[model samples]
Target: MRTTHPHPTNAVEPPIAGTAEARRVSPNAGWWRVIGTVLGIMLLLVAYYWVHKPLDLSLVLRLGGLLLDLAVNIALFVAGGALGRALLASLNWAVVSRGERIAFEALAGLGVISTGALLAGMAGLFRGVFLWLIVAVAFLIAMRRGGGSWLVDARAFTRALRPIDRWARLWGIVACALLAMALARALAPPFAWDALNYHLVGPARYLSEGRIVPAPDNFYLGFPQLLELLFGVAMSAFGRDTVAAPLHFGFGVLGLILVAGLVRRHTDVRAGWLAVALPLSATSFWLLFGWPYVDLAVFAYGAAVLVAAVNWREHRETGWLVVAGVALGFGAGTKYTAGLLAIGLAAMIVVEARSRALRPLLLAGGVA
Candidate 1:
């Protein structure tokens, strides 16, 4: 005690030095966080405008329409969020923490609950508005906390946008081929066999009545309403014009973008371009390219799942695993065949994790 009476004030200052080093290494982290918060608010506002704006309809009909729209939105959110998480995980970005991933999954489950309520159609405008408000809040919170790393990773963001930059010549050829395919598909007759059968007809019926009316003739077929509902909205806007087919093409294009972005995470530009081109070049893909069907949705969701699986493998993040599960669920919901893909992917993940004695696989499987 007597010897310690004259201790220097700087003796215990090393902890502060360590903290300063951390700040220097992650200097822009706070700024990135602030930007994320602002962007989150903007997204919420955009979502509200897109979903809640005035439309030409009676009050009762508008109320009913709101409920239907809410259902579709919730479903897309669950599927999209899951796919996004899996993709991010594959990239090995520690954007989301473990607790954040759990919370995100919980919010996604809540979206399912909201979907059930919206499908019931018993809830009026007030209920719909309340539910949507909760969703917006949850989304904002999740993005702010779980998406920080993504926001800060400017290099990854730039790379995703220009996946073809490294192989410009090859990508140009692929782009031209895709364009030609799109033009051919769009100019073709509207009464393609499937279009006449159920794809367009089912949604056309729904648009006419502003409600989902299943056709007994096609009762054996299972269709996910995500794309159908979108087609219904587009049909309402364009009055069944030939241009509606191009909308499906647009979705396919978006799916291609997602694939490119996902592949770019793990491979070089040439490999990523191949990933995007191979799927589009498939004959089966061209057959369904412009049709108003669920194939594009499946493609999009599948690409998303692949990205997520890669992320989970690289980062071992529980959040990515859960997100992969959600994506799998959404893919399964889109088409029954997708269930097989989901199951196979899940098994692969489980086996890989077990071999390595990784614990996150259990958590991911449970969430998925």
Candidate 2:
């Protein structure tokens, strides 16, 4: 029976259903991916155009002075910080560290610049870059000529970021991308109504006439001018409000850093990064960061206040308290809303130091 059987050569075979479906869908999937990528690119281009608007070659060309002014400001900030560090250490100013000293110097820079701008505006002195240069040079020359380095800790901090966990690295990239995008938006014409009305106008007016004049037209001009003073200096140098945007972005970054540092005290690095990501990743952050709004300024100073509080608690150092006070003052000065933040932090401080006598409360209340 087996020998008599012969198979039909034309017999049909069963179809490979998976292979058929896959073959049919594979080309469609490839097309879809291509379409999705193109759509994404187009959306990105459109967003950039909308946020950054018409590209101005003139503004691009004029950015050089802004860069120079920012550099000078940073240098001035470091030198002033170094000098403050030396003075505080020599005077036994509560055992401050280089990092704390740097923070102090930044606080000092803000106060000094704003005060100088106001005083000079009153005295008819703030006309050009010469005044800032003179002050910066004085600090640089008076930096004590040796011993502790102002930027050493900062460099070490940056280096330390290299070995962080994968989550931290991922969030860091996201944070940086957000910051860059916000900065890009900032480089364009300020679409923010408040900024166009007063923030930029106030600085522009101050820089133009070498004085901080009253703006009855817009209420924001009467608001805290601390943030604008830095911008005013740049405006004075460049004769425009071109440099203010990036300055705000920098403040946003500072806020994120301070928040992450504060959170890192009790948790893993990922938690700290998540804390950093929360604010920076929000759309509101970009809107505020790209404009001349003081919300970001509030964030920066508020975080500093909290971090300094924790630092004082950990180290029992009076310098940190002083730093916290200074930062809180600036935060309050930046916006009226900062009052709520101040009250909340005060409550936290009270709860945390309930065991201590009225001394801690007195110190905090008095300094604040």
In model 1, residue pairs whose N, Cα or C atoms come closer than 3 Å (at least 3 residues apart or on different chains), thus clashing, are 86-308, 87-307, 87-308, 89-311, 90-310, 90-311
Tens-place lDDT per residue, model 1, 318-360, is 6667666776666666567766766666676867677763455
TM-score, one value per model: 0.55, 0.72
Q: For each candidate, C-alpha RMSD in Å? A: 24.1, 8.9
Q: Which ten residues in a row have the lowest lDDT in candidate 1?
A: 120-129
The number of the candidate with the highest lDDT is 2
Full-model lDDT for every candidate:
0.54, 0.65
Superposition error at 347 for model 1 (Å): 1.4
lDDT of 2 at 345: 61
